[model samples]
Target: MEPVLPLVLPLRLRIRLAQGLWLVSWLLALASGLTLLCSGHLLVQLWHLGTFLAPSCPFSALPKVALAAGTLALGTGLVGAGASRASLDAARYPPWRAVLGPLLVAGTAGGGGLLVLALGLALGLPGSLAAGLEEGLGAALAHYKDTEVPGHCHAKRLMDELQLRHHCCGRHGYKDWFGVQWVSSRYLDPSDQDVVDQIQSNVEGLYLTDGVPFSCCNPHSPRPCLQSRLSDPHAHPLFDPRQPNLNLWAQGCHGVLLGHLQGLASMLGSMLAVTFPLQALVLVGLRYLQTALEAVGGVIDEEGETQGYLFPGGLKDMLRTAWLQGGAAHRPAPEEVPQEEAPPKEGLPEA
Candidate 1:
């Protein structure tokens, strides 16, 4: 099969292609940076709730947030440098910059894409995640209380807030609070209970009656439920065997939180789908421009006519002709010239 011929694009067209590729890549990088920054802020707002659900979560800290922002900034800087070089000083533009810019963009996109894909995949397996959360979250909460003793007051406050806002209870249900050390331990504020009572009374006071906070009760109730019947007008209790239907909520926050995470994953996936192809297109267009530049350079000679190495056979044919001429110039003539008669007579007389 014949090899496909390289395109010989006009210089003006080549310049336009280069500029377009740069524009697309630059916009993609800039947009990705902004997306990451906004996502990080959102994560921070939701972080308090997320940690209550999964204490060991990696995104609980700010480094991962910083990483997302940093990668985007790096890619944008490299892309801008490459674009300026390509436009203002084409001859000085390093080929390495062409490669580096795409690599940075691809790396950022690929990493974030894979992270989102993994989150989506994990959440998609709701059965496994649900099973794990049932025992894992309960254990995490219990451990936090045991270590903190008396209670992890800050965590408890946050947990209560989360439960109220999301309409959830303990890990599995309101009953799970019974296992938490903070509620079960009798030595809450062992030293000078009367002295420390004023500041910590509201939180500690819940243990006076039941382990669960009023937040565990349904928010729709008219009054605070913990006071009596958790303010449920019908006075439905959580663990009453006969009143299962009147419970605050059967579903756990695990599912609700995971669903929100799934939305974030979808957002990242969409961004990846859009940016990855644009980055690839920029790389391919730059490569085409490079090839076209080389082709044009080879075709135009000193006399400005299409010359050596312009076509597949051009260089070889020129070399072959040169070889044949060199060989003929060194070869002996087919016919020999006769010697002069005087030279013959002089040779005889000497003999």
Candidate 2:
């Protein structure tokens, strides 16, 4: 078989191709970043929850890394687009060139980070991530406290956030709360004696809470179900072995949370597939633009017409010959002022 020849686009077509492509790429990049950020807010809560683990966790860091990577890429893309447009200013070329080094560095780092994330997702996420969460969540539950308990409030807040946001209960199910130390260790505050008294009275055995957290209650459940000894009406003040707990969340948080992450990973994979190609094309177009900038004489098209400013003709003789050596435009020469001719008149001898 014969070797395939490269598709060489005409100079005019190449220039035209770069022309509005930046905008398209930038929009796509922005969408990708925004999607990552959408998950970032919830990740903050998980980050707090991870602190309960002796060595923290993998899932905890994933979204944070995504946030940082997306931010860096988005920022770099915005700057690059601005620079591309500013290239036409002709006055800003030096600054643009100067900034190019940092942009390249940042873009490379962000791109590399995104590639790594995509690769990680492609390899699959179930086993390690789920295992980490499964183990770390147990540790987190041991320290659970719905109210203030120095250095642990974040955990409680996160637990509640998780249950409420996911509309589920506990790590594995509402019953998981039975094994946890639900009451805060902090000294009872007089400011809210009723809640404190309720907490103290509910304690059973060494340390116990039979009912799930208030966050465990379904939003549509009656107001009475919001408090404990959280009776299911039929089994007030006592857990009934025979009856179903209608007030409590029937689903567990672990699966819902894990499934959410899987969705994000899938989304990330799709976005990466689309984004990388657009970025590559944008970079290729920029390479051509780079050549045009260095040449400073406009590219010659297949029809023999110049596509940009050129010397001795195009755009004020290449903008007043300022870019003669690919540099800034030169200033116009000053006008000559005329002097009085009295001395010449006094010595008016014929030449």
Candidate 3:
């Protein structure tokens, strides 16, 4: 086997690696933070829709937004400190006094804390998969249909927007509202004789053939499907000649909304995939540079202080100093060292 290489790399290589890792980690962190904020915004919008029909307990995305902001702030501060430490001239400032130890400590605390929170969220997500979205929505819709007063205009607007944007019908389909008390209830479908017969029996107003909400119709459809109209008067033109029925979207808003949320989650997972490893690389590079710094010695020229050694006990010494300097919320008094009585001096009696 060839002779073993030194534990540390050359100064030039270390410097270059340190700079590259620091820059990459900082950029990745910044990008991740922005992505997380966007994801949180998507979640909050969905929550607004979910609580639209049923406003029992409001879902607020404040916590998610706050967490993202906190992470961004901490990452930015730590990266800055690490970069400052790395840039310090080895000849004038030792690694410890260059503040590398404190910076590393802060970095480790921030990174480890984020990792723990992520792990906790991942573990807890499975417990609230749907959180009664389907059941609660069905009940709320049923109650709304029965009540003629039009209780939740906000929710109705949200649903209309959702339907228009996603090209979907009701919660499941246009048929989900077939049993509603509205006059347009009869305009579900004429092809299904059973449904038609049911509507005819339950019809409170004039008998008209069927269609979906105006929002569900394609914008350029020959005949406008109006929200006020019980059914589109020109049904043949509403449908694309290729497919059956009115060419309206048959899927539900619930699934599409949930999918938006799931995409947010996936975005978060991808960010973590990039960030976790990038952070580890940054930490390792900083550590290597710090070690290299140790060997160079005597950063500051002092008569009494040890050359190249600002901290004598490594991290322990740094922590002690930080605590003494009021870094902690409550600083503890230093421990007292017991002293032994001295032996009798020449011609002098001992105490």
lDDT (CA) for every model shown? 0.51, 0.58, 0.53
Ranking by lDDT: 2, 3, 1
Q: Where does candidate 2 have its weakest 10-residue lDDT segment?
A: 303-312
lDDT of 2 by residue, 206-236 (tens): 2454677788888886634533444345646
Full-model lDDT, candidate 3: 0.53
Q: How many steric overlaps does candidate 3 have?
A: 4
lDDT string for model 3 (114-175, tens) is: 65465355344523435545655565444432323465434445556767887777677665
What are the C-alpha RMSDs, in order, of all predicted structures?
14.9, 15.1, 11.1
lDDT of 1: 0.51
lDDT, candidate 1, 1-351, per-residue tens: 221344545545555556676677676676556556545654665555554444444433332533454364436445643753464344555555446546544644664464354334433433333444555466556654443544454565666677778887767666565544444354556576653553355564443323465666776765444523332445544434344444365556666666665455456445544544554555455445444444444221212222111234445665787799999999977887787666444445655
Task: Give the lowest summed-lDDT range of ten residues in model 1.
Answer: 300-309
lDDT of 3 at 52: 35
